[model samples]
Target: MKKTTINYLHVGYWLLVLVQTLLVSLGTGVLGTTFDWRLFSQIVLPVKFLQVLSSAIFFYINYLFLIPVFLKKGNVIKYLPSLIATLLIFTPLYYFLEQRLYPMIGWKSYDADLNFWFAVMITLSSNFINIFLAILLSYLMDWRTMRIQKEIIEKEQFKTELAFLKSQVNPHYLFNTINDIYALTQQQSAEAPNALLKLSELLRYMLRESDDQFVPLSKEIIYLENVIELQKIGQKGLSFVNFEVVGEVNKLKIAPLILINFVENAFKHGTFNKKNNPINILIIIHEQLLHFQISNQINHVKKDKTGGIGLVNVKRRLSLIYPEKHELTIHQLENEFIVDLKIALYD
Candidate 1:
């Protein structure tokens, strides 16, 4: 809480207590309540002044010192005795202040006609009310502060983990692409110039757009298309991957680079039999819902190991970003591997 807010709570609570004390003192419950100015100023004011000041002192002592030192540490034994000790110390001090300060200030002192133990009991009971309020407010404020801190830490973790995943996965793909461009240059192939240009565009997209939390669906689609084109060039102009987009991509947005891992995974693991498309990716959009599917023929020669961030990283990303907003299913059939994913988009 802000310091001003906390101050307001304290001031308001004490004011309420003072009002209640005045009401009881002036016989509020007894039908004809009369406000005697002299009685209020002389007797009630002096007594209430001492009561309120002492209560406020003990409240801060318990709130700022005792509670954290004892109760928060689960030391109830020490905490309860500490409360009793402070109440004992402050109750006697109230009498001493009344005897000395009231005469000096020319205000009449209050003396309730009761035995010593009975007066001590009454004082302890009233003091406990202040203690109870202090403890309640302290726990409430501390709990809220801890919860806010947890949420901030979680958000930071999300960003850091996402960035880490993005960084770890790309070196493998970029290395292969660089090698392909280098071979094309050695042969002086005409496609070499175009490949280098496309790589430049891809690099620009990664550095500029991929850092964002979200990107337009059109930009993501274009990025994917450019990736497929570069991969085709890397394969010596063979069409081993097929990508299909259904429905309008306008006005839609998605997490940047979210879909790239599945495509890269397909290229890493799938066999090209020269019979059918080695990798097939299909994406469908309707309203704010998206359905994505990718499948590739099993390349038994490939194993479940890669230097790139793999399916685990992608799964973690989807959970963190989409949470209950997405569904994913993976199937490993005898001859093919398939991934089906659905996401509910947000504005």
Candidate 2:
């Protein structure tokens, strides 16, 4: 809620309390007598006004000072003693204004009709209710404020994690692409110029379009196609790479750079030994869900321990952004490594 709205609500609440206090004081009469203008102006208004003033004082004391200082800090020992002392001090003050001050203003005091101990107990009981209500209100407001702050902190953390994951992905992809371009240049292949052009387009997409939290599925697919084209430029004539998109991808949206890591990993490990087996990639979108599968022949002897950072970073990003909305499975067989990922987009 807006701060101004909260402030208006607070003002409304105090106005309501003031109105109710005025009605009770002006109607029925506190001294158990019929409504009389003279008595009201002389006795009831002054007496009830003083009582309401005392209630407001005690309420604010508990709400603004005592609750935050002692009760909120879990210092019950000090809280109880301080509360009792405040009530004891204020109860007598309320009694004096209602009893002793009446006679000084040329009106009969009610003290002669009631026992001293009974009056003191009655005053304390009434003040206790006001103070307790104030404490409860303070606690509820504090809890609400804490809850809002916690949500804000969690949102900031999520953004930071996403940025860190994207940073890792950018460097990893650029490093591998540069190596590919360098290899072509060393061989003095004519494909070097064309490969550099594809690299420029890929870099433009990464820098401009992929900055959003979610991008159109079509754009992601195009990016994957570009990556495959770039990777294929340096491959041998007998190497095989196939990419297929199976359902509609018109308006579907997904996290940027999520699927490329798996494709990168496939090419990195699948062709390490120059095997003739094909690397397969399939993406299907149906019923507001996306299913992606990739499989490749593994060269276990050429595996590097630190080369799995792309996969690790993608997994962490998936967990943070999608949480229970996505599922991932990996399988390693004697000759092939496979990955299956499913994500629900309706939510």
* Top lDDT hit: 1
Residue-level lDDT tens digits of model 1 in 1-347: 68899799888988888877777766643223666677677766767767787778888999999998999999999999998888777766765555566556554345553455654676687677778877898899899999989999999998999898877556678999999999999999999999999889888888889888888988888888888888988888665777899988888889888888888888877775454656888999998898999999877787556533578888888998899999999998988889999988755
- 36, model 2: CA deviation in Å? 13
Question: Which residue runs does candidate 1 get wrong by more than 4 Å?
Answer: 1-4, 19-53, 70-82, 96-119, 136-160, 271-278, 300-309
The candidate 2 region of ten consecutive residues with least summed lDDT is 106-115
Query: Cα lDDT of model 1 overall?
Result: 0.81
Cα error, candidate 1, residue 32 (Å): 6.3
Candidate 2 accuracy as lDDT: 0.80
List lDDT for all candidates, in order.
0.81, 0.80
Candidate with the greatest TM-score versus the true structure: 1
Q: List the residue pairs that clash in candidate 1.
A: none
